[model samples]
Target chain A: MSDLNNMTAAESAATKAAVMNQVPGPEIEGQSPLHHADLASLAKQGPKTSGVHLRELKLLGHLTLRCNPANADQLAAVERVLGVALPLQPLTSSENGNYSIRWMSPDEWLILVPGLETFDIETKFRDEMPGHYSLVNSSGGSTVLELSGENVVELLKKATPIDLHAKSFPVGKVVSTLLAKSTATIRRTGDQRFELVIRRSFSDYIWLWIQDASLEFGLVVEA
Target chain B: MLHIYCPHCGEYREEEEFHCAGQAHIARPLEPEACSDQEWGEYLFFRKNPRGLHHELWVHAAGCRKFFNMTRDTQSYEIKEVYKIGEQPSVVAE
Candidate 1:
């Protein structure tokens, strides 16, 4: 647990919002949501070639921002922090270097940054951003899985009801919808590649579901 | 499965993405103290079970998580129109 009581009065006032380093030092190994499954070992022993390739982009900073898109100051503040403006268009994502912002709703956006930069970004937002808004760090609550390969779209179609056609769901599009029995924020990174942001608790179920669904197509675990 | 349009998301998502929240436009009595037992009972328990065109409240649970109104045909299961929560239904029961 983090030391909330040990924080000084000035530090407490400055960081009214909670911010903590989720990743430990080099001595302590950090585990992803699917750590128990040992996908890295499976990647070493599993088939070299498969129709579906799965890789977990573990420990990224997941921040949920809720503010009026129409607010010019809020937009300017975000651009200053991320070096990129928020993607105001619905279902779109804007990326600059390691920071990517996906429009979750008219008033909400999900921003992803390097894990180590989480606290710094939060502090900057609190210090600079203006108006009634919310910035929530949800990195511990979810993890991102990058899926790509020949049959990747086929596997996703079996799980979700959304149309996976490239014409309809172009690259860079994001959607919060059902993936198998659980929910995932699915984003198309390429014609056959997708990035799924799923809950930590449901990660195991989704992994199992993907394995079962990919049996016919064959699954390749990537480190 | 029924495909419902989410006005907020401005796209048609699957029915699984949404949860039906029963009848829409049911306003609570402004003066509860002035109402009798029958009025209170009607307000709390009674709801219309219309078979034709019906107005419904639904939440886009998996999508935007915003609540909206859907004017649907209960018989044919056809969604006539979908609007935001505060907006009026363009399609109504005739």
Candidate 2:
């Protein structure tokens, strides 16, 4: 693994350029330009490294599943297919390898898998799980960005009103909450890192918000 | 400028998402045999125009379309509590 801390500013810029060049996402056509801030400069500046680390989690497979948790057979089928049990313990997650499942609501969940494995997982669920469940292939509809380092929790509070105290949101917890003008499913990935699941339509807006919020602290954007 | 909490969405949404249902917690007279005309008159006419911390009913019309209760400070327009229609408030009105 690359030594993120050892990377020079020039190297950081190069990595960002490469990533942006490689995975140039389709431009959102009708997105009204943000009035209060410059989104492009914000996305370019990324997160402050000293207090917050931001990385664009590009090309991951995101799927939204809505199903009746009370249906034993169906729930079991999902478990068998995902290898990780659906976190039925409200506002929790179950991770297996690089994949994780977040309980979005009583009947909904947000599943994150490696970019390459997204399609396969969706296929498996379609073939295996049964009943009145709706699985939407939101892989192209949204993206994940990892926010780590110190002050992440404080940054989150600035964006949302949800009680994010450690007692309320411990590790292995996931919550779909309002982030500024948009919505995000925030999952605690580590002691300092959080994985934000944001929709494509509002990705730019949230990215801009993160940059402004992390300005006082140094921001480090990783590929 | 109403802040309404959606039970299904779990977000305190803008007033655009909710519709007010006026007074709540009014118990209907079970039987005519047990109630006087004055009691019925009081029940129908005596609405609590509380100055503060009033429990009002609202429907998440644009969201889950579910009815819920909101304990609000009428003077400042600050919501103190939001609960499902059948559930009790966690904190009592001050």
Candidate 3:
């Protein structure tokens, strides 16, 4: 029981790294759609480069918690269990180094932490968070695609109807919107780097769509 | 596309999740003798079709299924603001 609650940072990180290594990383074998564009030259052209930072965010812990934000006791219990309070403000997130929580809805949120922390977070939530709340483990259900080239925002606007303007969606903003036939929790990680959370079932289709959309720009699959 | 903010869900969803309901904030006259014919006609039939920014009511059919108001730009399809029923448009109200 004590072993479950207390884990060294290094030990947890190493375990997480091992788990990620085992999971079949992004299938780099297949040719990406925008393979022909010259990324080196496009980088000089600016943010429009295709396949700018296509990284497969693997083995990251993803959990879904649904509860009433009006319930102050439940919110406090969740904070105590995770050692980080859930971000109640809509579309906002609070991260404590390894753990980050995204406000998904008035009664729902997505909590992300190191991959190995998945079970621990779940156990803690189950033990602490009370009332009519649900915690679902969705790590295997979805994966992340980081789109960072200059043209990435333009490419996303083409795929989704949502406005991707800097004024509307500044850095640190997260949105769960439609991506072609699938759903994506799009997050702006940096100035040019945008992270997309896509479900596993529709990954192949969206991947194909992304490749096709970014054809004019170069698509580079990072190792 | 219109961004409809759901009061229950507390997030602005795509227009696909919403269905337009035209104008809101309407009230029915309590007594027939209390209002004139012109006031009754205006209440029953009048609607604003502004060319630029317009206040329109929408229902979150796919999400919380609640009715809400959205202020949208007619030309650019940009949603300026979204608020609940009985509440003023925050963007245009400001």
Best of the candidates, DockQ: 1
lDDT-wise, the better of 1 and 3 is 1
Ranking by DockQ: 1, 3, 2
**Model 3, CA-based lDDT:** 0.69
Residue pairs in clash, model 3: A47-A150, A47-A151, A48-A150, A48-A151, A50-A218
Q: What is the TM-score of chain A alone in each candidate?
A: 0.90, 0.76, 0.74
Candidate 2 chain A lDDT trough over 10 residues, lowest sum: A16-25
Candidate 2 displacement at residue A89 in angstroms: 2.2
Off by over 4 Å in 2: A1-49, B1-94
| Backbone atom clashes (below 3 Å) for every candidate | 0, 5, 5
Q: Candidate 1: TM-score?
A: 0.92
Question: Candidate 1's residue-wise lDDT over A1-223, tens digit each?
Answer: 4353343334444656666656675578778899999989999999989899999999898999997788787789789989999988888898999999987888899999988788889888877676567789999999999999999999999999999998879999999999997999999989899999999999999999999999999999999
Cα lDDT for residue B22, candidate 3: 89
- Return the clash pairs for model 1, or none: none
- In model 2, the Cα lDDT at residue A222 comes to 62
TM for every model, in the order presented, reads 0.92, 0.63, 0.62
Which lDDT tens digits does candidate 3 get at residues B1-94?
5445676566566777668898766678888678899988988899887777888888755444467777888777777877877888767633
